[model samples]
Target: MSAPKVTVLDYGSGNVRSVVRALEHVGAEVTLSAKSQDVLNADGLVVPGVGAFAAVMKGLKDVDALRLIGRRVAGGRPVLGICVGLQILFDEGVEHGVRTAGMGEWPGKVERLQAEVVPHMGWNTVSPPEDSVLFNGIEDERFYFVHSYGVQHWDFDVSQPMMKPPQVTWSDHGGRFIAAVENGPLSATQFHPEKSGDAGAQLLRNWIGRLGKP
Candidate 1:
């Protein structure tokens, strides 16, 4: 079979090249583009972001990428968000006491980590749910993180019959916080899998493996 075609949304967010390179290394035909059709027609879409929450949201709006993301998820297409990309998937984000609205794919708020140390950097282990596809073989391995704010609490409750709850992964720095989330058609990570070396590569492969599955 041909490799999966994946689009890395190019909305002026830094650290995108590494994400593209990582996906390529994982056997995906990666394209870095902000074109509407490119974002919509790909087998998978990756939204990578760095720096501040408000700034990232602004950049996404500038490119009208948020609407495209919503449409993709609504149609049951797969999309992955990394770093600040993950943060903007929520209802809102509060950084440095400033509040910014998010895409609201999930209900929750992203806030500063309660830990004394800001910007939880370097390698850290994650706690993936048993059914997590993203952490398949790398369950006990560590991934790289570089952020000060994250969703400290999970507020989502599945109300539909036969609908499964999202698989949430956790990690620790000074306190426990959300490390990753796997909801149908939508997934995100607070860490940078592209920079996590072998473990991260395996995670990307795991995600890519499920690109067209029901």
Candidate 2:
């Protein structure tokens, strides 16, 4: 089979090269595009970001990438978010006392981690939910994380059968927070898979495999 065509959205934030290299290493034909239209046709779209919430949102808005993500997701297309990429999928984010609206794909807000030490950097084990595709073969491994803010709790409705509950992975520093989430065609991770070494590679492979499925 041919490599999956993955687009690493470049909205002027985050380490786009590292993400491109990592995706290429995992059997993906990667393209780093700033154009919003590129994401629509990709087999999978990766939204990677680093820096403050409002700033990153501005970058996304500048390139109209936020609308692209929302449109693709609404069509049941596959989209993956990394770090702040994951955080912005929620309703809003609060950083340094500033509240900024997010893409609102999911309910909740990104807030500062309650940990004594901020920017929860380094490798940490994740507790993946049962039947998690993102952690299929690499559930026991650790992934790299570097951030001071995150979604402290999941806010999706679990009572509706039509809206299947997302598979959530949890990790902790001072208190538990969302590590990863798999919701239908939408998936995201609080950790940086591009910097997580071999374990991260396996996770990418899993996601790539999903891209090839019907």
Candidate 3:
């Protein structure tokens, strides 16, 4: 009954420490690192970033982390990304291009919400996706979200099989906007689960549960 090793990427993101603390709070043997090897060796990886996508992208590249991330996912290691980390998994980002282009795992664009004030920040409702391991224990769950740019055209790039992939579960926010997505061992969320308190802690547990190695 050994605790699982979970590595949280600390690529100079503002909330990396918070995410590590939260993961530890949920009993994960958390390792915080800016190193690619640490991520590659871990049983699971969590990428949490807050700030300009371009800067985050550069940080990842500086340490040669993106290649490791790609290899890890390809090699069957479970992975998760939060907030901007998830947003950049696509092809392009239109928010303050301090950093541009995505890791391109999922396809889409990140754009500022017009007609409404940018940077929607606060707690909002999340529609549960059936069989979502990330939503293992929750109801009427409202988590903290802070961002000006929201996802658009996610379904277009996401393969139909992947969109409905047996392993890919989703939490829908705006019918089309993907709040959370899971592909096999990899999962992501646009909300700050660590800042969301009890429910956030629950999310950590749920993802850990998917490791299948107790």
Ranking by TM-score: 1, 2, 3
Question: How well does each candidate superpose onto the true structure, as a TM-score?
Answer: 0.98, 0.97, 0.88
Q: What does candidate 2 score on TM?
A: 0.97
Relative to the true structure, how large is the alpha-carbon lDDT of every model?
Answer: 0.94, 0.92, 0.77
lDDT of 3 by residue, 89-205 (tens): 877788654437898777677776552444677887777666677887685788888876767554543345535553333343333455777777668888899999898889889
Stretches > 4 Å off in candidate 3? 96-99, 156-176, 212-214
| Span of 10 residues, lowest total lDDT, candidate 2 | 154-163
lDDT tens digits by residue: candidate 1, 1-214: 9999999999999989999999999999999999999999999999999999999999999999999999999999999999998999999999878999999888889988889888798999999988789999899998999999999888787788787788899999888889999999999999999999999999999999999999
Model 1, C-alpha of 77: deviation from truth (Å):
0.6
Model 3 superposed RMSD (Cα): 2.9
Pairwise TM-score winner, candidates 1 and 3: 1
Screening candidate 1 with a backbone cut-off below 3 angstroms (N, C-alpha, C), the clashing residue pairs are: none
Candidate 2 achieves a global lDDT of: 0.92
Question: Which candidate leads the pack in lDDT?
Answer: 1
Error of 3 at 74 (Å): 0.2
At residue 186, give the lDDT of candidate 2: 95
